[model samples]
Target chain A: MRTAFYISDGTALTSEAFGHAMLSLFPMKFKHRTLPFIDSAEKATRCCQQINAAASEDGEKPLIFHTFVNTEIKHIINQSQGISYDFLDHYVEPMEAELGIKAQPKTNRTHGIHQDYNFRIDAVNYTLDNDDGVSTKEYGQADIILIGASRTGKTPTCLYLALQYGIKAANYPITEDDLDNLQLSYDLKMHRHKLFGLTIDVERLQSIRQERRANSRYASLEQCQLEINQIEHLFRQEAIPFLNSTHASVEELAAKIMDEAKLERHRY
Target chain B: MRTAFYISDGTALTSEAFGHAMLSLFPMKFKHRTLPFIDSAEKATRCCQQINAAASEDGEKPLIFHTFVNTEIKHIINQSQGISYDFLDHYVEPMEAELGIKAQPKTNRTHGIHQDYNFRIDAVNYTLDNDDGVSTKEYGQADIILIGASRTGKTPTCLYLALQYGIKAANYPITEDDLDNLQLSYDLKMHRHKLFGLTIDVERLQSIRQERRANSRYASLEQCQLEINQIEHLFRQEAIPFLNSTHASVEELAAKIMDEAKLERHRY
Candidate 1:
């Protein structure tokens, strides 16, 4: 049988998706297999050796799709004589060429120049910095603070903004205690001008919460309704620009925040 | 103030990611905003109107990055006066033309003859009845199944697959119960062949779990090691091919499965 091996250095998810997508598009068919290696260069080399041995024993030239960033694995594969393999570098190289930007497809950037600002901003927001029992002036450092009940897509939106836009986004949950108080976090209130609120339909929030907590009190529809209404009222009374996350995706919500905050989308 | 609107039918997360990625490569900065609307014709029209108003008020022809798909929005925008916009259709059309594909960039499939047999095989695999109950025989019906422990990137991988691929993949946790029981769920066993497992290093899983539930039994080093060892033994014993989810993206994970399972990847 004609064989195609999908070798992965990190995870093989993208490779598998692309392989399936490509197989669907192409008219040809081949026996397919995947080998996902962890952060080990040695394991990747061993896997390559296994593939080469299998191909040689079968006396068939196997088509290999190797996806990895480890130079050791690459060197081993390049030296292998038994199997005919193609690297995914061919498919990804063009996108960079066309886009006129050099993004390392395999190396995920945690922080650097040309990284998504939205991701960085969110990363900065979630980190805690406290002094004694009281909060410090950390709130003033936030570019924007998102307040909403759990399951309102606050965290994801904050992350997307910080990771993709390089905007420093912070988010706080409107816990039952916060709802009862009908006020922003004490620390957040100090920087209330930068605070934004996210409110979603109780029914929607309930459904989302249910996915995580099943039958917990936090996932209860009644509790969701009570909290959403109180949060909305508090946001309006306090004049925090609020958004309904009922039907919006994280991308949509972040977009709404950028619009309302009049913030420039910092790309690089 | 030059305004740029990134409008999309997708969840705002993707819109913002694409917008930010694109803008990162651009040379100049503009007043950026994202406006997300549900699949309402009126909302789309109103968004177009808002773009026009914003552009006119700013006295600069705003570069409206329209990520939406409704033809009516395009029709309305084309009919409107004094605004410039870049539709995804036009943006990818030249590229499509260069690629010699008569199909549009957005349209996924062509109407005509049967294409790849491998995709047809995947279609059949989902339909085949299995004697084992573990087989989500409807595994084909899964948007995505994430098989991992408490913190082996299962949830994020699942969310990414669902959000990015729009695949209806379902995820099942491989708990101690499943392992002690010596088999996956009846439905999963029946669809065992369709099941794609995600494996990660014990240390990595522990660290991630610790972030969510610190100092707990589930997050403990010894507990994590045992669970990982047990789960890995089960995967190996069952002969279920798996991937390590460490440092791999959801895109890569889902792609790997699609490739391994030989499923069709639909265009967004």
Candidate 2:
């Protein structure tokens, strides 16, 4: 087993993204360590020690994926025993040439707080307030409304939309009570344009609900199938756009919804 | 403003991360567009047209940051008028050589559903259930607990932890009522090692709370100052680790806490 390090003078998020994408190309696993905010010479020296230690312990040269604005610190890490891959180093020069602007490298620029930061916080609060059909009053303010039966991956998807894209996503759970009538509420009908639906395989939904509420009717296979059928039918009859959550992660679902809904992402 | 596109066969998240980091180095604005799940040849052709249109409209070659696994799709995208920067292309060969494994290029592997995927979803559910001092009974299950004053950036940070790291983070808000005593509750005492304090500048806290509750006492500077003072005192007396969230984004705060707390990010 080898080691992979994502080190940076800032949040190291971009480093992680780059390294993770790169590593996913191979079919092997390595010990992962992220050293973030390593802005000082002293910290960089200590990071070198960790890299060397990992090398000695594993008897394999560690892989260092780093993005550093501070040249002195980057110089120190580049001296370590690990094989260095500065993902930004290759592109920045070409990009600067292409854009006719020199890259003014700076720490924290990648994930720094900007003017749109407040919009993300506001979106988070809005999503939380409107989660799980808690209130339909703020549907007018939502960028998109995700409606689905319980355990169909609504709440997490809403939160991801808020956190990642600054989208005001409010979710309504189609409950057992709604299984009978299978009709949209007055409020949802009023905001039909904003409505997007989610459906899951009966087994997956049952397994998820089982973990939450074991052996209950809510977790029963029959209940799960009936609910998905009704809700998806409702989506079709009402002409609501929807997706299957059975095969998607929150990131996938959020991005798909953003693309399909053609919503303006408030944050870059 | 020139347009910058983050396109991919899958989520396009890595493309966004790489492109954003690269673009942030230049002091300019870009009209950002993200095209995710462009997995088909037809979608690739449409994407090429969009890129060509952007190039013509901007009167400059648009910046395209993309990661595609399908070669046919990637080839079509590469032929677009926009200057393509497939960040993954430059490194995959080198990485594969070093690892002695042929790169298994596959779509969705970067942001795919996997075994650890459930951990993230579960973390999201746990964080949501235990948010904003809502419940403490489940604190025993939390990997880390964030204690903070109102509007000091507790909820969003916790969600980021759960979503990004698969760390089950629970946040408890330290209210004005607790300002007088400013002592750790019994439950907190039992898990003092898990507790991480967050403090914000009085002015920022007041302004943030003001947005939530217009003119309430909670939104007053004096009240915020009082709570922060008592909370800092408690943090010092109890030997609890703390960080100031005043100038930090949720990503920064979460990364800092993960570092200081020596937290193992359950996601790679």
Candidate 3:
């Protein structure tokens, strides 16, 4: 059995992301553990002892991924029995050399409260308030408006964009009424330049809707097929940019939408 | 003026995080650009040309942070007239050395649809359904239940935990009646082991509430003070672990809660 440890002085988000990426490359089962907020030398020392114990008990060296800003804490953890991969140590020097500037090793700055925190909070609120076309009176406030049939992965994508990038994303569900006429809503037409469409395969849409309401007309394959066809036709006729959500994850869809829309990510 | 470019073969989340961390160390205005899904050699070449042009126009080397899985694409982008910091290039070798395995250069694997994707979607659904103590019947399903007075930053923290870590989090608001009685709700008492409390300064709570309802008694300083005092006392009486949310960001609060509650982060 193998063990993987993610350690950091803050939330360990960076270490976790890098560790997961690297670990997924290998074909092995791993017992993942996370030790966050190891900001002090004492905490680091205790964490190292724990890691060493795990290594000895497992009869294999544990893989430790760390992003410690404090040199002292990082040094202590590095002396542990496990094979350590210090994320900051590996890349910060190269970045400094390339940019001709020294990076300030600030702990927790990646997710700390900065000038952009309020912007992120406001974006989340905006996305929640404007979700599912609940309120179109504030369409002008959105950076992008996602239009799609229900169960096309719109709400989660909007929430992801708003939370991750602080982008004010609002979503509107393209109902049967709208799809039948092949016309955009008056509010959506006013903001046509900001519209992005999402369409999914009939089978996937049927399956998703089935989970919500089993054996209903809304979850029927014929209904899903009809809606998808009409939506795609409307998109092509209106010259609106759209993507297929059947194969792409929410993160990919959000990133692609932001790129196609030329929306700037709000720095936080 | 400075330009910071974050490039990647897939979502570019890693590049964006590292670039933002490095840029925050410097106190200067920067025009940040994100270029994601550069999955081909042709796209890489075009991106390098853009970087070179930006460098020449700015009269200073632009900073390019990248995580290209394709070696050829990485080589092409590295040759651009800019300072390049490749996240994967710097760390992959050491990992290979430690693990005795070659890292697979897979694009879009970091945020792909894995087994954990459904877990995250379910967690988000769970959080939304159980938000603001609207439905406590399913407290058994929650990994952690956050309790606080109104405007104590519970909802956002719960959502962050759910979205980022795929943890099923539910939140309860401590109303004036509960505070006056200085007792936990009957439903919450049943799940005492899963309870985590949040407290905020009276002024901060008042300000947050004022934004929702201005000049009302509920948003007044006296009400905030009374509720905070009672809530803290209730928390102490019930032996519930809690944190002050007045100064901590949502990310920090979520991480700390997970740590203190010994809640495992559900990997996605």
Candidate 4:
């Protein structure tokens, strides 16, 4: 198999993003490697050797997706045997002309600390503190509160929202007791506008719960069906917006919620 | 302020990454907006109207960085009153020729559900369960274990590692009592090869602690200085690699640790 390298003078995150996006369009698999923080002439020389080694060992020119603030360093990598795709380089000049400003390339600018850094950390802490119906007192400060049947993927979705978009996401689990009444609590009712529901197929929920508590009544298909049935009914009756997470990744669920909730992301 | 839009038919994560990476080059602020999940011609028409409105509102052509798999939807967006930069357009043909294959574009392919999605969820659960020295019994399964003084940025980095790379990262916070002998515990010793350390500036550590407990002994600068001193000494004596998190963001820290440890990432 051919190899693909993502190299940069800083975090190499943008290079990885570019390469990954492009590679996803192809049907075949490649060996992926990332060489980040390559900030020196010596490191660039060593990187060239690695690229050449991969080329000879794989009997094909490796694909290199790289971003470098230093032209000399970039030139060194370009001299290697690999096929280099400087994706951003093709558009920077046109963008400069359109924006009427010269580009000031700098290392680490793409994924560095910014004024919004504190917001991300604070969001993470807030999400952790308010996870899994731990406390409803802080619901007033939440940007969006996710309520769903257990094992429908509330915790990971909340963490992704906080970590990626800096959204203050808190989640509450709808359990067996809540199933009897099938009503939103006063705390959730007070924040109804911020409520978002998640539901999963009964078999998916049963399998997930089975891994947690094997052979228990909670993991039984009957119980899973009953819980999902009531919770989804409650969502429809209360006019709460919701989605099925049976086939969605956490990224998809988080992005969909951010859009449907119309929440302004405290973007990085 | 000028307006810049990131639009896509799916989650728009790739569009956001591409736009943010490019925009970070210019030293100017622009009002940023993201329009995601615009998969229909009707939604595309609405998006164009919004783009035109932003153009009229800002008195300039709004800059659009978009990726659309649907040609009809792309055509609708192309009619908008904005300066469009179809970034990936220039490279696909050349890459296709190089790889001897046709480019197959699909919505949500860049950030969609994949076989490795389960690894990410499991890693997140593992990281949360093993957070802040909560349990060392699972250290054997960790790809990397981060050790540092409290409030030195262990939790957020671990979460990022798990979410981004699907690496099981567990963190342990070194407290004041552990500063006496400054020796690794038996559990940590068993997994010493997987250990990586983090340190921060005394001033920053004190301020972070101060927010959690103001005017407390643990938040004192002198005390923070002492703990950092002992921890740094311990890392050097034990030949453990460490980095200062005072100036690094979570992305930077996670990437650095992954590179230094040379752990294989379960790429998405």
The global C-alpha lDDT for each of the candidates, from Candidate 1 onward, is 0.57, 0.91, 0.85, 0.91
Each candidate structure's TM-score, on Cα atoms with residue i matched to residue i, is 0.44, 0.98, 0.95, 0.99
User: Which segments of model 4 are wrong by more than 4 Å?
Assistant: none
Residue by residue across A77-189, what tens digits does model 4's lDDT show? 99999999987898899999999999998877878898899899999999999999999999999999999998899999999999889999999999888877889988999
lDDT of 3 by residue, B1-268 (tens): 6688999888888788777766766556677888899989999999999898888888888899887767899899999997887666667777777777887766778877777777877888888889898999999999999999988888888888887889999999999777767888799999999999999999988998899899999999999999999899999999999999987878889989988999887773
Q: For every candidate, give the share of true A-B contacts it also has.
A: 0.08, 0.88, 0.56, 0.76
Error (Å) of candidate 2 at residue B21 is: 0.7
Please say which candidate is ahead in DockQ: 2 or 3: 2
Error of 1 at A63 (Å): 23
lDDT of 3: 0.85
Give per-residue CA lDDT, model 2, range B7-111, as digits (tens).
Answer: 988888999999999998999988999999898999999999999999989998999999888889989999999888989788988888788889987678888
lDDT of 4 by residue, B112-143 (tens): 78899889989999999999999999999999
Model 2: lDDT to the true structure: 0.91
Best by lDDT: 4
Order of quality (lDDT): 4, 2, 3, 1
Model 3 achieves a DockQ score of 0.62
| Candidate scoring better on DockQ of 1 and 3 | 3
What candidate 2 gets wrong by more than 4 Å, as runs, is: none
Whichever of 1 and 4 has more lDDT, that candidate is 4
Deviation (Å) of A70 in candidate 3: 2.0
Candidate 1's residue-wise lDDT over A1-268, tens digit each? 5455656653443444344433333344456666654347677667667677767765665555554556666677656553433323433344345335574544422112343432442343342222111343565666777777776766656655654455667777778877767876677678889888888888878886787689999899999989888888888899999888665545556766876787655553
Query: How much is B162 displaced in model 3, in angstroms?
Result: 1.5
